[model samples]
Target: MSSTATTTEAAPTVELSTLPLRGGEKKAEEKAEEYKYAHLLPHFSEDRYPPLEPYKHIDPGHRALKHANPRAFLDSAERVVELTPHLGTDVKGINLANLDSDGRDQLALEVARRGLMVFRDQRDFIDRGPEFYKKWGQHFGRLHVHPTSGHPKGYPEIHLVYRDGNTSFNFEVDDSITTTVWHSDVSYELQPPGLTTFFLLASPPTGGDTLFTSQVSALKKLSPQFVAFLKTLKAIHSGVEQAEFSRAGRRGGIVRRDPVEHVHPVVRKHPVTGEEALYVNRQFTRRIVGLKREESEAILRLLYDHIDKSADNQARVKWEPNTIVLWDNRVTAHSANVDFRHLPDARHGARITPQAERPQPALEGLDLSA
Candidate 1:
C-alpha cells in the first residue's frame, strides 16, 4: 500500500483563550500577523464562537435524486443567463429565500451540473441575516463549520469572506494581477464542501469580482490516455496552509484547529451529474501518491495550467451588493479578484458551505479487482 508522507515538524502551540476574535482588540507584537486580513465585520461581530467537534457528515440527499428537472427550477426565474458556456449561470428575478423544497432540490441538481449559479438583488436573503443564511445551507446538507476562518461572533456556520486595503493580502503588481490561488473550499476535509452558497454583503463599484473555472471542462480537455493514467492516481489534500492562517491569526485571533489531510482521486465523479472533474487544486492538493516529488510536480503543474488557461469555459462574476452565488465545490475552482484592494472600501460576504459525500472515483467500467 503506497501513500504520501505527512508533515512531521512541530507547530507552535497557541491557546484558544488567547485568540482574539477581531483586529484592534489586542496584538502580541507590533508586527503580529493575526491582526491582518479580516472576514468578520466589526458591527456584526461577537467575542468568541466555539470550535466544531471532530465529526463527519454523511449525506445522500440531492445527489441521489433521479427526477430533478433544471427547467422547472428556472420556471420562476425572470431571467436566466449563463455567465459562461460551461461555468456560471445567473438567474434573476428570484428570491432564494422563498424557494420551496422541490425547487431547492432541483436547484441543487442544477448547481451540480452548472458548476455555479448566480442570483442578483437578493434583498430578501440579505435581510434575513446570518442565521437565515445558515439555515438555507442546512437545507442542502450538513452545514460545515470552517476549520480556521473568522465568522460573526456567534455564527460558526457562516464563514466570513472579506477584503480591505488595510489587510496585507493586497498585491503590488505592474500587471494588475500577481497571483491567482485557485481552489475548492476545504478540499482537505474527509468530506469536502459540496454545495456552497456565498452571499455578497458589499463590493467596490469597479472591482472585487470572483473568477470560477470548470474542473469538468479541465478534465475533458485532457487526452484519453492522460486521463486514463490520472484515474489510477490519488492526490493528497492538506490543511497546513489553513492551519497557518489560524496560527498567524489572519482575522484577529481565530481558534486554531489542528490541520488535516485527506486523499481524493485525481479525477472525481460528480455524485449527481456523474461527470468527471479534475480534483487537484493549487491551494490544498499537496502531491500525487506513488510518484517522486519532481514527477508529481510536473504532472500537477500541467493540470493546474490547463485549468488556469481555460478562459472559454471560465466565468467572471461581478458581485453586486446583494448577490448570492451557489456553486458546486467538487466541479469548479474559484479565485477572488483583489484588484480593489487599493481602495479604502471593503469587499465583504458570508458563506455557508454544506459538506457532502466523499469524492468517488469516476471509474465505473474500469477494472474493479486490485
Candidate 2:
C-alpha cells in the first residue's frame, strides 16, 4: 500500500485507440477472456497458415535457422577475427552506432529472436551510472513509469538499488533458488511491455545468475494436441492476482488503473517477423476461455507445471558487474536467482526503461489447430 512518492505525473497512459491497426476501422472483437475452456484454433481458418503452435515449440524454427550465425555466413575474414566476449554477443558498450549497420541490425534481430542477450566485463558503461540509462534508453522507446510503486526516486527511467544502508528497494530474500518462479513484468496494464533493458551494477562474488526462457520456444515444444486446445482459449491477466498488498482498503482491493480489462490473442504474432508465438506466462496468465472454474484451474495447473518441468529449453546468464541484459518482453520470461546472498546486496547500477507495446488482434485467417 505504498504511494509512488514521486511528484511527477504518472507516465502517459497506454490507450488502445492510439495504436495504428492495418485498417482505421474499429470493431468489437469477441470477449472470450471469460470463457473457461475456449481455445484459439477451431475458431479461425486452418488453411491460411500452418499451425503456429509448432513454431512456438521448436528448438530451431525455419527462420531462426536461416540466420543462424550469419556472421559466419556473410562476414569476411576480419569480422570473424574478433574474439572479445563483449564484441561477440549483443552488448557492445553504449554506442551501437560504431558497429556496421548491417551487423548491428543482425545483432538486434538476434536479440529479438533469442529473447535475451548479454555483454560481459562492462566497466566503462556501468561506471557512468544512472544518467547513462537516459541516453541509450531514450533512443530505444518511451520510458515506462510504474503505475504504482514506480521507483523510489522521482526519475521514472530508473530503479536504483545499492548494498549499503537505507537507499531504496531492499531486494534481499533469504533463499537460494530464489527465482525458480517465472514472471513477466507489469502485465496488469492493457499495453504490456514490448521490451526491457536491465544492467547489473553490482554482482555477487559467487552464484547469482538470471534465467531466461523463450515463451515462444516453450509453446512450440507443446504437443500439437495441446497447442490446438490452447488456441481455442484466451486468459484473463491481472496484477490484482499478485500484488494483493497494493489493494489494501478497497471494495475488491483491486488497484486497477484502467477499470476496463484488456484482452490479447491467446497466441501472438511477432511484430517484426510475422511468425506467431504462444505468449502466456504463469505470473500474468490467469485462466482459460469457456471453461468452468475447476476446468480452467486444471488446464492452468498443467501448463504451469509443464513450463517448469521443461528445463532444457531455457538459458541462464551468470552475472558480472556492469553486465547489461536486454530482452524482448513479448517473447521471453525472466527470473532472478538468490544465490548471491553471501556476496552482498545486489544493487541496480541504473534504471529499467521498458518500451511501449502496440496491441494487435490476432489475424482472422490464422489457424491454431494443425
Candidate 3:
C-alpha cells in the first residue's frame, strides 16, 4: 500500500463538556485502565462455521422447509431482538465539537460497543462522508476496496449510493432498499476494512432497512465445545466479484485487479479490542481452506445455521434522508434490505469511506508468525 503524510496547522483542540477525559497524557492513562481486562481473556473459540451433514435433503413435497418455527433453532429464546428507538425524527446532525465532553465520550463508547450507530439529517452526509469517517478510522487502518460492486468514481475513498427507482423485494415493503445477505464488507482483502460508514441522502418512499449482526454475540451463544473446534479452521474469500468490477476499469484506470482469493481463519481477534469474533459470512466466503469440497460445504452449512438463526444479536436500521451509519466491519456482519423493488421514486444517497485492518489470529497463544 502507498503511504502519504500531509501536515496541517493543528486546530485549537476544543474541550468538549461531556467526556470526563481530555486528549493528551491524562486520556491515555484513563483509557488504559478502562480496557486493561480486555487483553486478558482472549475470545478464541472453534468451528466458527459448521457443516450441513446433520441436515437431510428436503423432500420436494415438503414446502414447509422454507419456513420453520423461528424458535426451532434454539431450545431457549435468548436471541429475540426488539427494535429500539435511537435517533429521533430530527433532521439535523449533532456536531461533536458542540457536544458536552461526556457526550463525546458516550458516543465514542457507544460506537466501540455496538460496532454501529445511526445519525439523522446529517448536514454534511454527502459532502464530507470520507473526511468524517477518517476521524475515527485513521486510528485503525486505511480504507479498502469492495471485493465487488464498488462504485467507479469513488476509488478507495468512498462508494456511490444509489437505489433502483421503483423496485422492492416482494417479501417486504419499502423503497427498493434492503440488505439481504449477511456479510462483512470486503474480507477478501489482505488487510480488510475495519470500519464502514454509509451516509444516506435520499431513501425511497417505502423500504430500506439495514441489518447488523454481532459476531461476538454469535460466538458467545454457541456450545463451548463447538467453539473450540472452530479455532483451527480457515475459509477462503474470493475476489471474482471485485475482480469483475476491475475488469471494467471504471475509474481513471485506478481499479486494478487484486490477486487475493481464498480462505482465512474462521475466527479472528479484533486488533484493538482483543476480542475474538466469527469471521466468515455468506458473502465472499467460498470454502474451508484445507478441506475437500464436500467437507467444506457440509461444515459451512452448519456454521451458517448457527449464525443465521441467531436473530437476537442483530439490530436493524431504517434509513431516511440525510442519515449516516458507521459500523465496525471487523466484528460485525450487515445486510442491506433489498426490498424496495417496486417503488417508482425509490432512491438513496450515499458516500462510503473504506477502512483497513490486519486480521488477528484466533488463538491468542499463537504467535503472529504461526
Candidate maximizing lDDT:
1
lDDT of each: 0.69, 0.47, 0.49
Report the error of model 1 at residue 215, Å.
0.4
lDDT of 3 at 139: 35
Name the regions of candidate 3 deviating beyond 4 angstroms. Answer: 1-93, 96-109, 125-140, 145-156, 166-179, 245-255, 365-370
Per-residue error (Å), model 2, residue 272: 0.6
How would you encode candidate 1's per-residue C-alpha lDDT over 1-370 as one tens digit per residue? 0001111111112222223454432331232233222223422234343544444553333433755454576787789998877888998988888887777887788888889999877877777877787778887778887655656656777776545445522111235344466789889877888988886555555766678889999888889999999998888998886667555645443444567787888888987778899999888999988789999999999988887887876888866656788889999998866666576544556778888877887875433121
Those runs of model 2 whose alpha carbons end farther than 4 Å from true positions after fitting are 1-107, 150-152, 160-178, 241-243, 246-261, 342-346, 349-351, 359-370
Task: Return whichever of 1 and 3 wins on lDDT.
Answer: 1
**lDDT at residue 307 of model 2 (Cα atoms):** 64
Q: At residue 174, what lDDT does model 3 achieve?
A: 31
True lDDT of residue 2, candidate 2: 8
Against the true structure, what is every candidate's RMSD? 9.1, 15.5, 18.5
Model 1 earns a TM-score of: 0.82
Runs of candidate 1 exceeding 4 Å displacement: 1-70, 168-177, 364-370
When 2 and 3 are scored with lDDT, the better candidate is: 3
Question: Candidate 2: deviation at residue 328, Å?
Answer: 1.0
Candidate 3 structure quality by residue, lDDT tens digits, 241-288: 545543443211122344466456788876545667888887678887
